[model samples]
Target: MSHQPDERQLSLNAFLHDTGHHEASWRHPESGAERIGDIAWFQDIARKVEAAKLDAVFLADGPAWWGTGHRPSNNFEPITLLTALATVTERIGLISTASTTFYEPFNLARLFASLDRISGGRAGWNIVTTFSEDAAYNFGLDGVPSHEERYARAQDFIDVVTKLWDSWEDDALVVDRESGDYVDTSKVHAIDHVGPYLKVRGPFSAPRTPQGRPVYVQAGSSNEGRAFAARNAEAIFTAHQTIEDARAFYDDIKSKARALGRNPDHVKVRPGISPFIADTTAEAEELSQYFNRLTVPAYGLTQLEKMAGTSLRHLELDERVPVEVFGGAGNVLDNNRSRRQVVANIVERDRPTLRELLHRLAGGRGHNVVAGTPVQVADTIQEWFEGGAADGFNVMPPLYPQLLDAFTGQVVPILQDRGLFRTEYAGTTLREHYGLPRPDSQYADEPALAVGT
Candidate 1:
C-alpha cells in the first residue's frame, strides 16, 4: 500500500559489465572488447548512461576469477572504477558491489565514505555475501563458510559499518580560522561496538557524508537474502525471467519491508533486462540469433554447473536439463538459491534442452531477455513497470557501445515519449534519484569522546 499509484516514474540503472552482459559479447564483431579494462571506455559508457537520465551506473564484481574460459570476465574493481567514473559525471549515481565475507567493516565503511565525498553524495553500496569457493581460497580460507554463517557475519558487518559511519555527527566539522578551531571535537562521538563477528572501535576516520550513508543496494533473492534486504536495502537488483515471477518477488519484498516497519516505497525492485533492439522485429530476432550462435556451449555448461552446484559436463547438449541433477533445491534453505531458482524456472516453464538453455541464458544471466524493435522493447518495459513487476530495470546491453547506443538512442526516446521515463535528471544525489531520504547521524545525541582518551 505504501507504493502509491500516483508515483510511477521508472527507475533505471545501467549495469556495466565488461563488453556487455552476453557471455560471448567480446567475440562479437561490433563490441569494444579489446578496451574492456580501459577507464576511458567505462567513462564513455557512463556518460552515455547519464545522458539518458538513468538513475545510476552499477558495476558487478567478485574477488576471484569468474571461470577459466573464453568468456570475458569482469576486470576492474568496482568501487575504485566507479569512483573514477564519478569524477567525470555530475548527476548519475555510482554503485559498486563489495562482499561482506571478504572485507572488514571499518575499511569498507571508509571506502564508501570516500566515494560518497568524491561523487558529491551520489554513492551506493551493493552488499554481497559472496558464494565462491575460489574467493575463500583467495582470502586464505580452506573452504567457503555455510550460507547461514555468511549471512550472520553480514548482519554483524553491516551493524559495525553503520555505527562507524555515524561516528562523526553532521555539526562536528566547524572550520573557523577566526576561532583557530578546525572542528567541533565536542560533537564527535565514539561508537565502541563489540559484536560476535567483529569489534570496531571508533571515532571513525571519516566525517559525516552528504547523504549520511551510501544508498544500500541488495541483489540477493534467497529467503535470508530477502529478509536482509527487507530490513536494510533501499533498492534491490533481482533476476526473474517472467512477469509472474517478477510480480511475486516485487510484492513479497515490499510486504516484508512493510511488516518490518519500513516503508515499502523505500524499497525499489528493479530486475535486470537485456534487450536486442533494431529497426524491425525481424532484424532484432536476427541480432539475438547472432549472439546466441556465438555462445560457447562449454562455457554455458560450466556456468550452469556453478549455478546448480553440480557437475553437468557429462550431460549431452541435445538432452533436456534433468531436474534431478539439482538434487531438489526447490525447498532447500541453503543452496545456490538464486541460480537454482533460475534453473528451476527454466525447467518448469519451457523444459529447455541444454543447448537451448545456454542460448536462453546467454543474454543476462538469469534476468529477462527480450528481442524486438525499439517500440516493442519500450512496450515490454512499460508493461512490467505498470504491471507491478518492476519499479524499473537494470538496462544491460548485450554488446557495449553499439547495443547501448541503440537502447539510448532508440528505445529510450520511446520510453520518454510515452512518459514512462525521465528526459532529464531531477536530482543530484543518488538517494534523491531513488526517492530515498538522507539519514541523520545515529550518534547525534551522544556525548563526544575523543580518540585514545
Candidate 2:
C-alpha cells in the first residue's frame, strides 16, 4: 500500500525586525518607526500572527549595531524584549537570537528555560555564532575569534546548555504539601561540563520547563554551521534566492542528519521570503520598485562596504564594483560569513553596476523577493513547498503593519483555503507547532533489556 502524505504539515514563521525586511522600510510614509520601542506594537503583530495561527514569530538580533546610527540603531535586547512580548500574546511561538560565542552557557540556558515556563512552553532559541567584528569590540574582545574557534565554542556551548536544561528531570519537581518538599533532590542531577571554551556546573535553578527544553533553531549555512545544525537543530532558518539552491541545501542538510542517525524530517528547513503584494501583478511590481527607489544610496553603499569588508568611500555611486575587491571571500567566506557566498554569487552572476547592486541587496540581503498579487504570492509559496525546496518560509514583510497587514489579510487566507496553512493553532508549545518532540533528558537512566544467553 502507498503511504499517504501528511496534509497538515506546513510550517510558517514571521521574522520580525525593527520596522520590516526592506532596508528603507522605516522611511515608508505608512510605516511606523515611532513605536519600535513600544511593546504594544510587537504585541499587536504577535496577536495578528497568532490569529492566523503562524508557527512562530522570530526576532533577529546582533550584539552590536552594524548599520549607521542615522536610522534606528539597534534598539532592544532580544531576551528581555521577548519576555515582555510573551505576556501580551497567547499562542504564537517566540524565537529569539542569542549568540553562543558571547554568552555563558548556564545563564543562557536558565533564561530560555524560564522563558519556556513563563510563556507556557512557547519559547524557542535561535542559536547563532557571532560573526561581526563590531560585536567583538562591544564584548571587550581585541578581535573576533576565528570561524573555526567560534563554531568549536558553539558546540561546547550547546553541550553545556543542554546539560543545564536536563539537570532537573521531569519528575524532579514535587510540591508535597505534608512533607513541605518542593523538589526531590535525588531526581536532580548536576552536569559538571568542562570543555575547551565552557566550564558550566549544573543543576540549574529552574526546573524542567513545559517542553523539557526550548526548541532549538539555527540559521547559519556554512559547512560547520550545517554540521552543527544537522547534529542538533530542530528547525533551520536559511536564505535562498532560488528553488534549486533551497532544494540543494535542504537535501544536503537532511542527508547529513540521516548519516548521523537522526530523523531527517525533524530538521525543518525554511528559507527567508519577502513578498510585496498588491491587487495586481503590475501594482505589486510598482510597489517593490517604489521601495527600491526610496532606498538611500549612501546607506546602501555603507552596507555594501560592510559586506565587501573594504572601504567604498572613494567609489562613485553609479560606478561598477571591482570583481577583485572582495578578496575572494576567505576560506569560510568573508564579509558576513553566512551571506558572503550569496553576495559573491549575485555579483558574479549579474555583473550589475553599483547602483543596480544596491537595489538588488535592498530587499533583505539576497532573500527571494517576490512582487505579485495574493494569488501569485500564494502560488510561489505553494510551488516551493510542493516542489520539496522548502518545508515553509520565514515571512519577511518589506514594511510593518502595512506590509504585514497586506500579507496576513490577503495571502494568508488564500493559503488557508488551499490547505497550505493552518486556520487555527493545533498545538500550544513551539515544539508542537513545528511537530517536534520534546527532547528527553540525556542524563536520565535507561532500563536494561532482558536477553536469553
TM-score of each: 0.96, 0.93
Off by over 4 Å in 2: 1-5, 313-315, 326-336, 446-453
lDDT per residue as tens, model 1, 122-202: 999999999999999999999788888898899999989998898888988889999998878887777888988898788
Backbone collision count in every prediction?
0, 0
* lDDT for predicted candidate 1 compared with the true structure: 0.88
Best by lDDT, which number?
Answer: 1
Q: Against the unseen true structure, what C-alpha lDDT does each candidate score?
A: 0.88, 0.84
Where is model 2 poorest over a 10-residue stretch in terms of lDDT? 444-453
Error of 2 at 238 (Å): 0.8
- For model 1, what is the error of residue 150's alpha carbon versus the real structure, in angstroms, after optimal superposition? 0.6
Deviating ranges (above 4 Å) for candidate 1: 1-6, 328-336
